[model samples]
Target: MKPAVRTGNHYITGDVACAEGAIAAGCRFFGAYPITPATEVAEHMAERLPDVGGTFIQMEDEIAAMASILGAAWTGVKTMTATSGPGFSLMMENLGLGVCTETPCVIVNVQRTGPSTGLPTQTGQGDMMQARWGSHGDYELIAIAPSSPQDCFYHTILAFNLSEKYRVPVLVMADEIVGHMSEKVVIPDAREITLVSRPRPKGRKDRFRLYQPGPDGVAPMPAIGEGYNVHVTGLTHDERGYPVMTPEAQEEMMTRLKGKIRNNLDDIIRTEEYRMEDADIVIVSYGISVRTGLTAVDEARRLGYKVGLFRLITVWPFPEERIHAIAARVKGLITVEINLGQVHYEVERCAHGQAATYLVGDAGGKIIHPDKVVSLIQEVFQP
Candidate 1:
């Protein structure tokens, strides 16, 4: 190790913490484009990656940045990139390629207010849905949201580990507040961190099955120069990784691609429940929205209302089972997000009339206040 990893506690912004976390997670390459709110992540990585013998490349644009990371992942080394809003939109084509190829990589979106530079430096959670469905085609991805700089540090590491373990593009959706806010963060020693690497091919090199999935629906990821004839492409392919254009090939390939993440829902999905065991009203929120939702929950509790928080850690896959189970007992669910109602619909669908679902959000620029969230809870639960 040339620069070596830095292990200790320090006060830092979320973007910086994330860059440090990537280094701790053994990330040796960062490919990204500079954009507001997200540039700090790349800036820190540019400085730190070299200290640890990693490479940082500033691509011409978001499209090339996304492409660069995928190319790096093929070498069996942990890789990552950061972007937000417009840049995120540009990366969709390559993000699909990452998903189809089962490439293990981390994408950090330091979300800023936007609909085309709507508020470059302001915060917004508008991209929640885009993070999930931005890319074309029907496929699944793992996305985690963090509300604090501390969460940013740890979650980025988790994002990389999950990416390697599941062999998919794992996204860390950190909004402007958390990305720019400074907080006390604890960086643990290297040995304390647990990282996952894609399973390696065990068969004879001459007879290797490039895309043959294991019992877990994930195939071993061989390094680029590992003597295996790995044919990687975005096209639908069989077990050998060669492009094949046929309905049968499409069905078989797509099924495994989505199934690998869906089938392991119990392991892939993560959520945080606060006093939900007996609460009549529950607040569903993620990203920066979690902060205000919890504030509302606390005030509701003070007023003697049975209110609890259902904060989402793993935003993608929607945590359907948990939402349904909670909705069954709660009197109402107040879905809180910065976007108008992207995640609210998902919660409502899963609730299925077991409980009423309501939304409290808007377009973005300024964050929704805690009082607004409290008022929504009041409307839903007021007698």
Candidate 2:
């Protein structure tokens, strides 16, 4: 593995690199429950937090873990928590709270297989849809998928910045493969990294409204004991942050929550297009599946196929527009994933009859192989 080069140093493994990135990004609060694949993230944070004057707490359960991080964030601290699928499920209620309250925090879901306890120690991108709608309400979430250890470090910092900027819970949707994979990650110097601080409340403390919009849709957050008696709730509220049951207030609040993400879609959406220009086939994949899909593209091209790869770095807010554009040009779209075709549907929807969409997936505790993906591409092009 090559050394990870960032600001000035290198590191190994995505989990450790993520911890170092968070520390460097000024993340001082971590609350989590230990689970396989993601447990290392919590462990690393536990060992490193004290040295950097940060706080790391192991909560009773994933629910508590989720809640604790939000509470800590309310204290004006940039906070985060890590969990696997089951633990992520446990955190959904609080996750909804973070959404409605518009709290800024990062939740790292290092995914493993399962409807329940499917594959504890294995990797899967099964949680892609859950990251968007798991909270059981209408909300928009920022989800980032990292394909390599180095990206894990950088995207983790980006995740924190987006969470603070949008005042929404940003999900760093990592998987067992990327989380455990050891690779070179460049650690940039602390001073060089651009860190975003939460917008603070200004103007008269007596007249301050917690939900009042700033220049951007995000409201300035004043922490507890900041001399501003700001009230926050899940219920639809006015600028004063008091609950308002009126339809107008409800509509206004919900639109802002959803629109804030949509309005800034360009800044939040990110993807990598490989050999897309003048290509006949495009493989859309993410997380560890993308690594295999990339190799498959190369193998297909070697066989004289005009194959390309589209890697989604930011999973949610779904990159629909870009996929739609590419779908029109490609001869066919193949989606290779670790599940029984979740993202495959997205590809089909975006293709909109422009191209054929194919699914190559594995749901039985192993990754879809590159050869299988290559074979699928060949089969699609067959006469």
| Number of the top TM-score candidate | 1
**Per-residue lDDT of model 1, residues 1-383, tens digit only:** 45445678889999998898888888999998999899999999998888778899999999999999999999878999999999999999999999999999999999988888888879999888899999999999999999999898889989998899889999999999999999999888778888887888897998998888999999998998889978898998999999999999999998999899999999988899888878999999998899988888888888788999999999997899999999889889999888888999999999999998999987887778889978877775762
Every candidate's lDDT: 0.90, 0.88
lDDT of 2: 0.88
lDDT of 2 by residue, 183-244 (tens): 88888667668899889887899988888887678899999998898788988888888999
Candidate 1 residue runs with Cα over 4 Å from true position? 1-4
Instruction: Estimate TM-scores for all models.
Output: 0.98, 0.96
Candidate 2 local Cα displacement, residue 243, angstroms: 0.9
RMSD of model 1 against the true structure: 1.1
